[model samples]
Target: MEWFILFIVGVVGGVIGSLMGLGGGVIVVPALLYLSAYGLIGDISPQLAVGTSLLAVIATGLSSTLAYYKKGNVDIKSGLLFFIGSGPGGVFGSWLNGFLDAETFTLYFGIFIILVSLLLFLQNRLTPVDLPKDNRVMMTYVDAKGIEHQYGYHLPIAVIISFVVGCTSGLFGIGGGALMVPAMLLLFRFPPHIAVATSMFMILLSSTTSSLTHLYLGNIEWILALLLVPGAWFGAKMGAAINTRLKPVTVVLLLRIFLLIFGLRLIIDGLL
Candidate 1:
């Protein structure tokens, strides 16, 4: 039953996270921790859960990035650029993750959840940053409609933000897109489709490094990661298929509420 539960979690997290470009760690982490707390899974620590969730995130990122790339939504160059910062940040965060016990990890994770939940919710609101063009690295993209769009960011600012988000990703076992997407939308002025697709690409790049660090730390649950991979992979494909047919506003709202409650519960558990 526990294994089955985890498989299902992979599917749910992968599908929703693919759409959101978060790589499913937000869902997977909380689910793993909750199951462990309830004895539905055996002796799973926060580090293990995070490591496992990050592994699943890789599967989701790979699946989603491929699908988005074929659709011409992914900004491969930008993704690589951000990875310059995020990759190193992920390694640092992974090293830091090894120092925390269950209680402390849980409390910090709970706070992270709340912050991520709020960020995801706010992303739906379209706010323009309109940065100075001179200070920005401008990008030109031609959408499916053949309409050319201009977007980009200040190099230093983008790198710094990606680094911080990447650190959070490795520390919490996420894809780093929870914060990245919003920053892309609001700060970097990326188009929605472009932001999400590029975020997946960056996640794909960064998660690899982060997972390697986790492996070195022996924080990953290899067996569970294997189980999660298949479901996460397939679910990401499903989500990408739905991208053209759906808008995620309603879904995100519900996700925010669910995460809010779950995050608070984890906080309480940590305090206890």
Candidate 2:
């Protein structure tokens, strides 16, 4: 029953996460924590849940990224730069996670979720800042339907933001896509599809590194991860297909609603 539950959760998480470029950690982490609290997982620690989520994110990110890449939605150069900055930060965050107790971790995770929710809610209301015309790292991308998008961004700012996103991902076992996608959209003026696709690529790198660090620290539950991967894989492909058909405003609204609900739930759980 527990394994079945994990699989179902993975399916749901992967679908929503892939659509929004999130690595499904927001869904997986909270769900696992709830199962553990209810004695379904036999006293599993929150840290273990988080670690397993990160491991599962590897599958989710890889599957979604491949789909996006084939559709030409991914921005490889930006994603690579983000990955480079995030790598060390991921390692450090994993190491830090080891020192936190379950209660403290839960509390902080709740706070983090709420903060992210607020950011998502506010993102659509904010005015986007365009990159200067003369920027050296301008990007022109053609999507699956042969639609072209042109944008530019300050590389240093992106790198710095990615480093912070990596740390958050490692700490919470999230893919950091929720944060990264919004930053790419608002700060870098990236098209919504491109931002989501690129975020998945970056999550692939960040989650892998973070998961390995958690593995070294003995935080992961391999059986749980095994159960989650298959569902996540199938769901990711479905979600990627759905993404290509959805409007950007619709996607953002869905993400905002999910974040708000999940974030509030986490906060309530922590307090109680």
Candidate 3:
């Protein structure tokens, strides 16, 4: 029963994370913590939860990146550039994660999740930035509908943002797409599909680095991570397929509500 639930958690995390490029850590880390607290799983500490979640996230990133790439949504050039900063940031974040205790991890993760929920709500509301053409490094995409969209960013700024995203990924086991996707949309003017795809590419790279760091620290729960990988991998493919087929507005709204409620629960648990 526990194994079944863990697989389900992985599937759900992969689907949602791939849909929005938000990374499965938002789902995986919290679920592991909750289950561990109930003693349904083995003695899992905060570090183990984060480390295991990141491993699962690697599957999600790799699976989703492949799916997105076939659709021509991935911006390979920009992804490589962003990796310049995100790679090191992920390493640093994983190192930092070692310092956190259970109570502190729960509280901080709760706050971060709430902020992520709010960020999603507010992401579409942000007004577009007007940058001079010469200052912007541009890329253009033609969507399935044959509509062309132009997006660009300041190279240094993009790298800086990716670094911060990577740090959060390493520290929290999130793929860092929650912050990265929106930043790409608002700051870099990336199309939604492009932002998500590119963010997943970045996630694949950073999660690999972060997971290696965790592996060295002996933080990952190997058994749990293995169970999660298959589900996350396939679910990510399903998510990419669903995204290309239709927009599930109702599902997204409900997901936000779940995040809010779950995040609040974590805060209460930490306080208690």
Q: Which candidate gets the maximum TM-score versus the true structure?
A: 3
Candidate 3 structure, TM-score to reference:
0.97
Lowest summed lDDT window (length 10), candidate 1: 119-128
Q: Which stretches of candidate 1 lie over 4 Å from their true place?
A: none
**Candidate 3 clashing pairs, residues 3+ apart or interchain:** none
lDDT (CA) per prediction: 0.87, 0.84, 0.90
Name the Cα RMSD for model 3: 1.1
TM-scores of the candidates in the order shown: 0.97, 0.93, 0.97
Candidate 3 lDDT (Cα, whole model)?
0.90
lDDT of 3 by residue, 162-268 (tens): 99999999999998999999899888889888888889999999999999999999999989998898889988998889888888677678888988998898888
**Which ranking of candidates, highest lDDT first?**
3, 1, 2
Model 2 lDDT tens row, 97-209: 88878777887887888788788788778988865666547888776667887777777787888988898889899889878988988888899888988998999999999
Q: What TM-score would you give candidate 1 relative to the actual structure?
A: 0.97
Better of 1 and 2 by TM-score: 1
Among all windows of 10 consecutive residues in model 2, the one with the lowest summed lDDT is 247-256
- Report lDDT (Cα) of residue 212, candidate 3: 95
Give candidate 1's whole-model lDDT: 0.87
- lDDT tens per residue, model 1, 1-272: 77888889999888887888888898898888888878887789878988889999999999999999899999988999999899999999998998999999998888888887777667667577777778678999998889898888988888999998789889998889988989998888888889989998999888889989999888898888888888899889888877756987777788899888888988988899
